[model samples]
Target: MQIIELNQLTKTYGGARGITDLSFTVEHGEIFGFIGPNGAGKSTTIRTMLGLIYPTSGSAKIFGKDCIAHGPEIKMEIGYLPSEVFYYDNMRVKDLLHYSASFYKKDCSKRIKELAEIMELDLSKKMDDLSLGNKKKVGIVQGLLHKPKLIILDEPTSGLDPLMQQRFFELLEEENRKGATILFSSHILSEVQRLCNRVAIIKEGRLMALEKISALKENTYKKFKLETLTKVDASSFAIPGVTEWTADERTISFLFKGNINDVMKKIAEMELINIWVEEPDLEEIFMHYYVKEDGSRHEHVSA
Candidate 1:
């Protein structure tokens, strides 16, 4: 089942920046990655889907219902952790969580305790006294306490240490295994690569690509690096598949996606000292979308 949907969803703030013509979907039981650098409309798209902000054009749907029209009902099944967290300064962590849990129909007390222990969050600490990381931990605990069906996270790991981040990922995986759907948005490519089943790449307020994580990494660019015995012309490496090409005297490098033999044959024509051919990771593949000249988009997956 489609858990969330966006169709030509656009939001503009007059002269200010916002998302445009964005479209995608998250499946019922998959972890979907929404990735882009800052100002790329990651947050705007999310806020629109959550009904925090109305779109200037088009629409979004959650649980097969129009988002804005059914926000209250839709939100009941959602667990959301914003990029930044703010709370009453005087309240203790436990108090804030309890207040948040009050909105739900079920009693989240026991679940809150379990999550707090797993996250190693100190419930007695006052919100004003907690560090940024601790504050983020509270957000995590608050979001998951009700055992929501759909989890929406925006840049959720900013303040966590490596160990904490690992724990959080494990926790998310556990939830996913138990049938929670996740929509994770972040600029951190590595984390997204490790956790998500599929990803929707956005740039400059536009939807760029959507594909399964494995398929994307498999069919995308391959990294090529060679050190020639002598000076080489950068133009010599400008094959049809080559992109983000660069050369400095005896060193040359670029990303290629076509038949390996074609590129190898070109390299064979040159005198080289050493060479390295490697599969490009998600991060490098993502860079190609950002820096490409023709502005061509990758294969789009149907929402």
Candidate 2:
């Protein structure tokens, strides 16, 4: 089933862009990745979906109900972790989680304890005394204590250590198996590459590409490596489609995402001892969408 639907969803402020004619559907029980560079309208799109801000035109639905009209009802089934977690400084961690749980009108005590143990959060500590990573832990426990059917996370691992991140991912995977759908938004391509089944990429508030992770890997993203007898300036090989590259005195290595001919033509002009071109990593493929086929970079704009 389509759990979330965005139909021609456009939002704008005075004269600036928010999100324009955005349309996509997130399936039930799937991990959907929402990705874009800074100022790509990712947050705006999410806020609109949650009805935190009204859309100037178009509409959205969660669980088949109008988002704005049924915001409260829909939110009851959602667990959200914002990028930055803030709370009343004086409150103890347990108190805060219980307070957040009050909205659901159920006993989340056992569930809260379970999540706290998994996240390694100290409920005895005061909110102000917790480190950034620990505060994020609180947010995680708070969000999941209710066991909501849908989870929305925005840069949820910003302050988490690597070990905690691994544990958190395991937790998410467990939730998914128990019939939860996740909407994961992050700038970390590796995380998205590992966790998301499909991805929706947007730019300047407009949908760019929506593809299955499998297809994305099979797409036209290639890694190029060159070894030359003589040293060549790395800047000389900076083709329109190459964004990620490393160059040494006699070696230039990079990933390419545009017309094969454009890069091949440039390489033909070079004196090479050995050339290697192969499929790039799935993470690198994510960068392909940010650049236009014409080789220009996507400009970052404020949401």
Candidate 3:
């Protein structure tokens, strides 16, 4: 039931880096999160998958078919919403949607109307007349109008307000329940944390980590900040689980991943004015991955 498969999926732009030896898969009915900062090759990998761009090396398959050789067949089941949407400005929303639907055999008018209503998109408005948010709504409607089997969303919530985003997430969840496989690409950690069952983290055009959300959180790192009455030697806190710390006069903070008892005992020996120990959020963990120069932390997943 692997709907999508990537094997040594490398893409390079001349001498610049794109994705290097990337490999992963999206199984049926799974909400797979593809995460990384901008320029981390999220878009590159996606474009290649969609066959909009050819890879310098490696290959991708969708629905068990080669993406390049059988792109048109594979694309019939995919609904893709890019971060930035572009359309014929002269066409009304209704006209453009109808045009897009023409590519498929079945009638998408009724589904288009339903999606527009759910997204609150004004079908009467010309593409040029809509705001960025409204245009994004149009993109959502167009992408889902055909009731595609696989949804590929790249930074799909960019221009939406909080309420709209909530609604959109609900819509995607509904689609998932209806047996649609989704590949959600975004830099927003919280959104990925909330919706994705499994995530593939990429950095500098390389896969960094791939794990279930539960596993990632279970291995959660703790953030600690302490204000001491006096300065202490940095090496004093160099325990097995403690990462490097940032020190400023009497204040210091670092991330810890193991036995809290050991850290508590060490802190008990210190003269502190105040201290704060809390669970690090995904953003903090994301920064941890970003700063890692070595790829040793990546957990390679087989396709």
Candidate 4:
């Protein structure tokens, strides 16, 4: 079941740039990664779904209900953590949790305590006295305490340490196992690659590609680097599927998209000192979709 859906969703600012004709869906009980570089339409798309911002065109739906018309009803079953954390300075952590929990119809004390212990949060500290990381922890706890059916996190690990980040992932996984749907947005490729079952790559407010993580790894291009013992003209080896070739003296690196056996046979004929094949990370793939030669958008993803 698709818990969230965005169809031809477009948002335009006075400057005439935001998400464009973007469409995607999140399945129930799945971790969906919304990934892109900074200034990409990630936040714009997220805000539109939350009804925090109205779209210029198109529509968004959560659990089959129109987002704009049914935001209050849908939000009751959703929990959100924004990229930045904001809290009342004079309020203690516990007080803030209590206040946030009060908004929900059910008690969240047990869940809040469990989340606090897992996050190693100190509830006695005043918001003004806490560090940036601690403030983020409070936000996390508040989001998870309600045990909502849908959780939307934007750069959720911004201020967390490595240990805390690991714990957070575990918590998210646990929530997923309990039948919650999640849409997490982040620039950290490895985290998304590791946690998400499916990912949607957005660039300049457009949806570039959407695929299952496994399928993407299997079908995407591979990077091969070879250090030849003798100077070799790498240009002679170019093939139909291969793209983005670069060479410097005896070292050559390029993305290969054909059969591995054929590429290996060609390389074996050369006097290679060292050779390695690696898959491009999500960040590298994102760059390919966003950055332009003249420092402008080269390819715009459809919204």
Candidate 5:
């Protein structure tokens, strides 16, 4: 089932861009990664889908219903953790969570206690006395207390330590096993690579790439570094499917996207001191979309 849908969804602030012709769908029981840096419309797209803001053009849908038309009903099944969490300074964590649970029309007391213990959150502390990380923990607990079916997380790990981040990922995985769909939006490529089944790369509020994580890593750019016995000719590595080529005396490096054997055959003829061929990580592959063949970044319209 399609859990979420955005068809030519666009939003703009006066003359500025929010997202342009953005389109994608989140499937049932899958972890979908919405990848982009700051001001890339990740938040705007999410907000539109959740009916926080009306779209300037196009439409968004959730659970097979128009988002704005049925927002109240749709939101009941959603668990959302915003990039930044804010709460009344005087409120205790326990009270805040209980208040959040009241909206779901179900008793979430037992679930809240379980989640608080798992998150190692101190419920007695007031919101004003907590650190940024603890505040984020409260957001996590508040979102999950009602056992929502669709979890939307925007940059969820910003304030967490590595250990806490690991625990949070494990918790998410457990929720997935019990049949929850996740839409994880973040600029952290490594986190997306580790946790998402597929990712939709967004830049300047438009879709860049959408593919399975395994296929994206397998078929994308390969980083090749070669050290020759003598000064290397630039033309020697100027084969097709190579971009961002650079050379310094005996060293030559570039990102190759074609057959590995073509490069291996070229390497067999070269007198080399050392060589290293590696798969480009998620960050490198993501940046490749914004890079021109001439090794310059494409100018983006800031949102």
Candidate 6:
């Protein structure tokens, strides 16, 4: 079932700095990614969906109910972690978790303990005394303790160390197994690539692309670098799908599209010492979507 849906969602600010014509959906038990650079409309869209901000035009729905008219009902099942963490300074980790748990009807103590162990968080520490990363752990614990049906996380792993970030992914996987729907927004492409099966890319308040990660990888170009035994000019090989080429004596590096067989065959006819092909990572794919000179959005395909 589609847990969340946006229909031509447009939320323009006084200076035209918000999302425009945004449309997407989050299905039940699916991990969805809302990806964009800083100043993109990602946060605006999220706030609009949460009914924290009203859209200038269009509609957002959660569980078949209008978000604006039914925010309280929708919020009951959502676990939201905003980009910034805020809490009472004097509150201890345990007290804060307990306070948050009070808003829900379910018993959350067992989940809280489990999250703390996984995150390696010290529940006895005062909020004011903890470092930024530790405080984020507290936020993570609070968000997951209630076992919300829908988890909406914005830059959720910002302050986490590498190990803690890995653990957080594990926790998300566990939550997914339990049938939670996730809408995770982040500028970090790698994290999104790792956790999200489908992603929507937004830029400058506009939706750039929406597709499955596997599809994006399949459709995108690949990079190739070669060191030939003899010097060869690779500029003639540049084509529409290919991009930037750098050549130094007998070594060349460039990007290409379509079948590698023809390109490799052509290169094989030349004197070649060694060659390597590198797949574009998520970051590279993301840059291609959001950083184009024309500022146009591409419709990404699902993997």
The runs of at least 3 residues in candidate 2 whose Cα sits more than 4 Å from the true structure, single-residue gaps closed, are: 220-253, 256-303
Against the true structure, candidate 6 reaches a TM-score of 0.82
Off by over 4 Å in 4: 220-283, 286-303
In order, candidate lDDTs are 0.88, 0.85, 0.89, 0.86, 0.87, 0.83
lDDT of 3 by residue, 110-180 (tens): 99988888899889999999999999999999889889999999999999999999999999999999999
What total of clashing residue pairs does each candidate reach?
A: 0, 0, 0, 3, 0, 4
What is candidate 6's lDDT per residue for 213-298, written digit by digit as tens? Answer: 78655666677888888677755664456666788888988777667776777776777788888766545655664355786545
List model 4 lDDT by residue over 176-226, tens digit each. Answer: 999999999987777887899998888778777787877655656678899
Candidate 6 local Cα displacement, residue 287, angstroms: 6.2
Lowest lDDT 10-residue stretch of candidate 4: 294-303
RMSD of 1: 4.1
What TM-score does model 2 achieve against the real structure? 0.81
Root-mean-square deviation per candidate: 4.1, 5.9, 4.0, 4.3, 4.9, 3.9
- Candidate 3 stretches with Cα past 4 Å from truth are 221-303
RMSD of 4: 4.3
Question: Which of candidates 1 and 2 is the stronger one according to lDDT?
Answer: 1
lDDT of 2 by residue, 1-303 (tens): 999999999999989988998888999999999876677788888888988999999999999999999999999999989878999999999999999999999999999999999998999999999999999999999889999999999889989999999999999999999999999997666688789999887766777778787665555577888998898886777677686788888988888877889999999998999999986553455456456789875542221
TM-score, structure 4 vs. true:
0.81
RMSD of 2: 5.9
Report the candidate with higher TM-score, 1 versus 4.
1
